[model samples]
Target: MPSPRPFSRYEFLIAWRYLRARRAEGGVSTMTWISLIGIALGVAALIATLAVRAGFRAEFVDTILGANAHASVYLSATSFTNELTGEVYTQSGRIEDYTDMAARLAAVPGVIRTAPVVKGQVMATAGDRANVAEVFGVTPQDFARIPRIVDPETSVGEIDAFPDGIAIGSGIARELGVVIGDRIRLISPQGAQTAFGTTPRVNAYPVTYIFSAGRYDIDRTRIYMPLPEAQSYFNREDVADEVEVYVEDPENIAALTLPLMEAGGDRALIWTWQDSSGSFLRALDIEDDVMFVILSVLVLIATMNITSGLIMLVKNKGRDIGILRTMGLTEGAVMRVFFLCGAFTGVIGTLAGVALGVVFALNVDHVMSAVNMISGGGAWDPSVRGIYELPARLRGIDIARAVGLSLTLSFLVTIFPARRAARMNPVEALRYE
Candidate 1:
């Protein structure tokens, strides 16, 4: 058997000549340019869309971790399950000695900070309206260290100034028609076991602060109060519901979890942010995957254009191929000649698309702003997304995938036409001449 010869420059020269052929000389037609542009646009659009999805996912992760800790140490004694609701009542983790355990956990290698908290559900009422919300009891100082508790519009303020002060989300403030310095009633469903056993236990607190957490659900349903005051109100004096833990590096939170569990003891239940936000993040992942498949269909359609152009080229160049075959060029070389013509378009288009996509992705926020300005519309409305600007980020892996898929499709589409051109009988191809 003979080894295959090295690729000859003659093959590339023929391919280039065929691509640049004028209509008079049976060269490339207008359709070739159209197909090339179609592929370029499709690739560019896919890259931009993927970048935006990636950026949004990152933003969401940061937002969630900003308000919540990396991990939490729950001190629950026992948990109950409601068969009907499928809700497990873990009923806040209680620690007998929060201070000692928190201090110990703080000294852990990866742990950055520890905060003890009390959590429950309570009804808040001011004026004639009342709404049920999640109440968190945390010291103002510790709460401030939790990343996003303070924004330009709001702050926890000084709870020490007013021992009985209350801090609520901005949405709660609107719903209850209350403001800072106004009194709102807090009703706990866990009533004291008295003569009227398990009625609602109610108390009034002055609103001292308002926080806007940038999440529609959390901003509307969250309430914050002093930890000591909450302990007294809930009859859990000197005890905390659980200890929330923050780590030095959120990406490597697992390093702190095992040590936290050891410090928290065998009975303690520790949960990470992943556990709490698992379903939500998974849904986002699924959406990204769906978008990728849908966008890739555009490239598929563009490849069809390549197929059409190559088929036309084969029909027009039948005589040329016959002559080339007669000149001692193998059938394989004939096929390669046509394949390179189509592959050239694919390669150039893919490169151009990559450059276009990266530029668009990096400047997506700016582009949106420009569009909004020109249209005189609030396209980047913060109220709609709780974000001032649309997000976008480029990843090398995404570009590689897009380019690979484009080139693969381009290469495959040419085989049918290239093979058809190669298989023509030299006699029949030249018989009419």
Candidate 2:
């Protein structure tokens, strides 16, 4: 066959031709196909895992920030002794007229809104089942300011709705076998001290709304009651346990601290959502990093096939190399041909893997659903994933990085055998044949 132009045009065609030629043409080999398959599979695995992890974290972060305040201001009193009487005295260190403090905090530049809240633990009983739940005393306006403690579809969170009823998480409802309109008794940790003695405070309220934040921990343990009722139950009326603060940018919430302290006064103790959930988010970051490393190793192992495939081609085509040398083909040209041979596998495999991975990540939820159906009912654990839905996120930057790694490994593997071809002794190579 006439040699095509030996530079860019000809070299690429020659390499591609070898990739597409049939086994009968002494071009395609089993190892070549294996190498392609290996690289493609590795790239796809990496992409799919990354997308899923990203999706899960985004969902987790959104859920957390929505349900919890960006920051909170808490006020409590510590008793001090009276110097003259030598008697212990309870001084007012608490934020007085907290409603005024909330308004002032709201005016701070970064502050988005503020709501007074009373948070406490209560034993909740629904029929025969009982669970300890975190109770929040909030107004309908407060619920609106916070993330949906109940599903919006439940219609229990309207500004005017649930006037005389409590909103509980769907997970708690399921656990207690309770539903909307069910009468549940809440026993507060605080008590009313009277002639009878200090006793646990108890009240019964009808469940008017059920909510799901897609967080198992919250769904199983969080419930909401009106602020006035909470104060009455805890016996701290005209007062609040804390002021929940929402800010414009929660990622930089530390910036709001000085302003908030100025508004809420020196006695205010502040906590941010990040402080509460930092460990969980950090754990997720570590997992993502580890996964990238593990999957990249898989690609490395896959590229190993290229090294063996190139070595095999050199051995099988020794006579061909000799004939090419006789025809005045330079050592450099020979090396280019072999190098292109490996590049064909790596580039083609990387592209194919990227396509496959993107498609798979986008449809991962469907794939998971199909698997669940095939495996029988309830194959997925709701407790582990919060709801039954799969989360998937894809980023262009991440995809590009993964593809780059695959191609780099693929192109590098061909160098060794290509060098050997460039240094081939044509006379000896033909002598054996």
Candidate 3:
């Protein structure tokens, strides 16, 4: 008769019988269940954590790039000598040719749009409430180009009416107890230049619009006004403080920096969003690495149970091994039989974990809503978390990493016990029986 192929039906049948044996027959049925459940939970936790991390990072970056410029160009200070006094004075940098500079920067290959901005800080008051606000003076057309401001779903009021009034964040409106069409007075410390020095400038403008950028800090402290009004209020006539530049791709902003500088001329100083928020991004990267390492340890521990469970099975099936060996079963066949037992548990557990994790990530927002309803609405705090709601995003690479870690550990730990079972002496095993 021809020799049976490797992993033939007989070996599979024997392995299945061993897995299905009852406890009364010296089976490790209970340990097998424990190992399967442990692995499933470990894999699920890792997948879920990675999903949340990815989602949070994406949300954070979206908020930043959506609400603000990718980069800004400012004029460097220049030293000028007084013609008659024979003295030199350093003049504060100002973008005197801001309109021309914006058009020039807009012509760069990767540049999408450019806007001249006049920014300042002032105290805002509405009735009895008052708060400090950082104001951005942008043209109505340029303000409409901001993704977060013009998103119909999140913003209220009209962009066309912005030039006649001012736009305040929802958080600022709440703080000042004001609504659209209400007047809010702004007080600036740098006012008219008189003999006794400058006085604070105070003016009131109707709240023509309100917006929510979904970020706590931005919504709480930022206000938008017409460029003309901002220039007049801040004492900068026919000049802008800086020019905000938006690019095609913010992540690869470095490639465009030299080009933008060349276009902006000698006095231009480019500051990117990366320069301001690089440390935060670096912290997030470190956090992702640390979380993966910690969760990998959990997976390793769960897979260790597979080792223990398989060792116990080898001990319980000692008499059966003796019979099978004496019946002409090769050592390789015996090892394959035991290997299938552990492999089955790992495969099934990983599939189940993947399903559970995917379902959880896809509906994480609804889950948070349900939780908030049950817990009386304190589940998420935007001020503390920097996001209005919890986010979870599933990525293929993350899932693959989790699956690879679990299966590698399971296969490696099964080898020792399977080899021991295969090397067993039938004479000695039957002698004990």
Q: How many backbone clashes does candidate 2 have?
A: 1
2 or 3, greater by TM-score: 3
Can you write out model 3's per-residue Cα lDDT over 1-433, one digit (the tens) per residue?
6767898998888888888868585448877888888888889989999999999999988999999999999989999899999899997788888989999999999899999999999999999899999999999999999998778798889888898899999999999998889999999998999999999999999999999998888899999999999999999898899999999999999899999998899988999999988799899999999999998898888888888889989988899999989999989999999988888888888888888888888989888989999999989999998878888889999999999998988888889999999999999889967
Q: Give the number of the best model, judged by TM-score.
A: 3
lDDT of 3: 0.91
Where model 2 places Cα greater than 4 Å from the true spot, the runs are 1-7, 21-28, 90-94, 154-159, 377-379, 385-388
Model 2: per-residue lDDT, tens digit, 214-277? 7788888998888888888877678888888999899899888878877887677788888888
lDDT for each residue of candidate 1 in 340-426, tens digit (9 for 90 to 100): 989988888888888899999988978997999898977766556654468897888888888998899889888998898889888
Which regions of candidate 1 deviate over 4 angstroms? 1-13, 20-30, 78-93, 151-164, 177-183, 191-194, 198-208, 251-256, 326-333, 359-390
Report the Cα lDDT for residue 60, model 2. Answer: 82
Structural similarity to truth (TM-score) of each candidate:
0.80, 0.92, 0.96
**Residue pair clashes in candidate 2:** 150-211
Residue 406 of model 3 has an lDDT of 87
Best prediction by lDDT: 3
